[model samples]
Target: MFTKILIANRGEIACRVARTARRLGIKTVAVYSTADAKAEHVKACDEAYWIGEAPAAESYLHGDKILAIAKLSGAQAIHPGYGFLSENAGFAESCKAAGVVFIGPPTQAIIAMGLKSESKRLMTEAKVPLVPGYHGADQAIDLLREQSQTIGYPQLIKASAGGGGKGMRVVKSFDEFDAALASAKREAISSFGNDAVLIERYLQKPRHVELQVFADTLGNVVHVFERDCSVQRRHQKVIEEAPAPQMTPELRHAMGQAAINAAKAIGYVGAGTVEFLLDQSGEFFFMEMNTRLQVEHPVTEMISGQDLVEWQLRVANGEPLPLTQEQLKINGHAFEARVYAETPERDFLPSTGRVSTLIAPETNDFVRIDTGIRQGDEVSMFYDPMIAKLIVWGQDRTQALQRLQEALSKYYIGGLNTNLEFLGNLARSADFAAGDVHTGFIEQHMAELFPEPSTPPDEVFAAALWCELDHTQARASKAQRQTLDPCSPWAIADAWRMNQASIDPFEFQVGEALYSIQGMQRNGTYYLKLATGEKPLSGERIQGDEWQIVLGQKTLRIKIIQSGNTWLVFWNNKVWHLNLHDPVHEADDQGVHGGGLTAPMAGTVLDVMVKVGDQVKAGDALMVMVAMKMEHTIAAPKEGIVQEIYFQVGDQVKDGDTLLSLE
Candidate 1:
């Protein structure tokens, strides 16, 4: 085995690779950009080096700079984690020329499967089952239109060199083919530097099942079963599982053999995945192959008891296969849910901010958390916005899924929007529990998945008041700290109420709704009154940042953290932000209002779709902003004429900065 290897990636994948390398007694080196100077991955490595600035093009994607760092650090190999430069054939070839081992498939294999069109041609020659579509090299628009008509309606236009849902579009009719093709091509060129595309038949309810296959220098290839990645949004997998639910032995065997054949046909080595689309009729067709370690490989590891990274290391060191195909067997069922820092209510837009608080579930033999963040870590706008991957294992699929739900509830994050609540809802949904999943699962259950916000229970509001009272008492005790008194009146709940009962009315706001509650002390007992009814309430601070509250027949544990003027209350696995209303210090509205377009988040303006003096209607795209690798368009709120344009393309703007004004 190599003594040291350089990880050519950052975030959780970098930390994940370091962990395995350390287990095998191999030293690990990490490279980071300016944005990740103090990142967890940097601290996880034995030695770290700064490559370039925050942009990936100037840092992570600069193959030459990474190669120079490898030489300087005396790293014998380079592990390209999963993203960035993982699947770059040129980078792999450069590593080989520099005499440093690349812990992935050979360059020839990567090139063979790099482009979808080329891969389809090769797979057809290998006798692999393929979907009916056009894989030709003609780039003419009229030719593509002809092909689309021949393939019938509801076809897919996919980027030849794309992954992660980028550069993909689905056309439902001939009338939409031209526009869809143009949009897909533009995205493909921007994302992958390639404008080539291929058309494929769009299946109504196809399940994405992929087989994990590995090969060695001696031409020994074996399969590690499969993972079902059918639950997706925007063509990206959100939830994944191993030993697909209700999979038959015969189908598994056939798919496994086909995957092996596909790898062998490309002369593949190291870890790779062969993806397929399983139709409703029990038939499957080849989709494409990923030439490196996958993001969701943990679920496969949990089920097969294999460390794929270690396998890649061994194979890169010219070692033979660890075990033959016959020796590998599935031990149990596993599930992996990707937790991202995004807003599900706003169409899953990526969110960026500092993580003020983070609480992860306790890990054991059955539950695992693969993450590279902690409290105070900033989710920047330079890379992917994924928070972590929650993996769980059990003796059966039901048990594994149940454990998944339990773990999600225990995970919590604050200071920014996240998909935790949405993930928990999906995990507990009846349809998901029953395993009725496909690529369209989220679309099919959109209503249940993104349900309207629920009103806070009365106990929750009472708990908030109890928290406020505790704070008041603590402050009073601190003020009286100079004089020590065993029977200080401040220590008593009703001490401030001298001879008569005191009723204090407070108003709070949650979102757009305002709630009013009155706290009263009657005969030394506390009660809260609302329009609904009156309830006796009591609370005690349990420890740091936690409190136990009792209201009527309900007992709850809540965490209350104050930020600025708002209090963040976490109860029953949900977070609520309550703002105290104080009329004394209220200020007049001075921010942007009426016909002004402001940025929703900090990002670089990618394009200005409208110019000054241009007329636009509601929902017309005015500009496009790119942040965290996702594009969000700013649209006109109502019909108006653009009077002024503030920022041009490539300008960096802060959150709430007015981009333009309409009259």
Candidate 2:
């Protein structure tokens, strides 16, 4: 085994690699950008090296800087985690040239699978089942259109070198073909520096099941079962599991053999994923092969009792295969839910801010949390917004789902909006629990998952009333203590008949809806009764200034503060700027609907597709902004003429900053 290896990545994957390296008695080195100078991954390594600035191109993507750091740190090998330079064939070749082992597949294998068009051709020769599509070298517009018609409508246009939903489009008709191809190519050029695309049949009800294949230097390749990554949004996986639910032994046997054949066809070594799109009719087609460790590899590790990273290290050291295909067996069902910092209700947009408070659930025999951050860690716009991955193992899928749901509820992130509720709902969905899932699961149930807020108006009222009562009594109790007697009449009591006038009436909005709340001091605690419900509420006092109240089975924890006439109740992960003004003092501050297009979050403008005075439709792309490595298109809000363009190509924009005007 190598004595030391440098992890050429950052965030949770870096930390994950260091953990596995420590188990193998190998010292680990970590490389970080300036933004991750004090990051958890840096702290977890034996030594840390500063690479470059915060942006990925200046830091994580700089292969030379990383190679220099590895050489200087006396690292014998380099482990490129999933993102950044992991699949860059040039980087792998450079490592070989420098006499430093790259703990992954050979450069030739990477290049073979890196380009989709070339890989499809290779798969065809290998006899691996492939979807019918166009991978020819002709880039002529009319020629591509002809191929699309040949392939059939409702086809997929994907970047030949794309991953993560970038440079991908699904066209349902021939009329939308030309525009989709252009847009996909533009995105492809920006994301992967390749405008070449391929057309393939788009299955309506498909499950993404990928086989985890590992091979040693001696040409011994074996399949480590499979993971069902069918739960996806925008073609990106959200939930994954190993030992796919309801998967038959015969199906597994055939798929495993096909995966081994695919890996061996490219002379693959180390850890790689052979992704297959399984149709509802029990037929599967080869999608593509990922030439590195995958993000959801943990679930496979838990079920197979294998450390894939250690396998990568051993394979890189030119070790022979330790196990054959017959040796591996699935132990149990495992699930991995990717916990992200985004709002599910607002179209799942990425959220950025400081994570003021992070309360992860207590771990047990069945639960594991792979995290790269802690409380006070800033979740900036500089990287991926994945907070952590919550993995759970059980004897079966039901038990695994139960453990996962419990863990999610206990997780508390204070500063930013997250999809905890969405995950929780998915865990309990009947269709999901029964394993009747597909790529369109979220799209089909979006309305049910993000229904209009069912939180009652009265619950908001009760929360406000309870908050005010707690504030009033605490203040009066303090004043009474300063008086001469220890047990004065004003001393805090649990149940004392209190005057209604002594307490305050509260009102707040939980969105666009309003509620009325009033509370009275009863005993030493505050009792609030909302107008919508007959049940009264009692607050659970915590610390000196905060109170937690349970209303309608959901807990509302708030920090109380007074700001002039309004009482700010920090609830629903936001500051509720309640209007406490009298009827005469209140002024309407209704929101206006018109404005120039605003950047949803901080990101770089990849393209300004339109300019000043350009005619636009309601959903026409004004520009594409790439933030946190995700592309978001700013579109026109209404059919109008473009009045102004405030940004240009390659401009870094902040959230809420206007990019253009449509009038």
TM-score of each: 0.94, 0.89
Worst 10 residues of 1 by lDDT: 490-499
Cα lDDT tens digits, model 2, 1-663, are: 899999999889999999989998999999988899999999999999999999888999999999999899999999999878999999999999999999899899999998999999999999999988899878899999999999997899999987877789999999999989998998888777899999999998899999999998888999999999999876778999998878999999999999999999999999999999999889999999999999999999989888888888888999977778888888889999998888777567788887866766678769999989888888878788899999999988888888887777666676677776688778778799899888889988886666666554444455556665666668777777787885866565434444533354566554565566656555554456555544546767787546777764567675655544545455443334454535565557522246567777777888888877889888887898887767777777789998888899888987778787777
Among the numbered candidates, top TM-score falls to 1
TM-score of model 1 vs. true structure? 0.94
Task: Report the number of backbone clashes for model 1.
Answer: 0
Candidate 2 versus the native: TM-score?
Answer: 0.89
Considering only N, C-alpha and C atoms within 3 Å, which residue pairs clash in candidate 1? none
Q: Candidate 1: lDDT of 6?
A: 99
RMSD of each: 2.6, 4.5
Clashes of each: 0, 6
Which lDDT value does model 1 have at 339?
A: 91
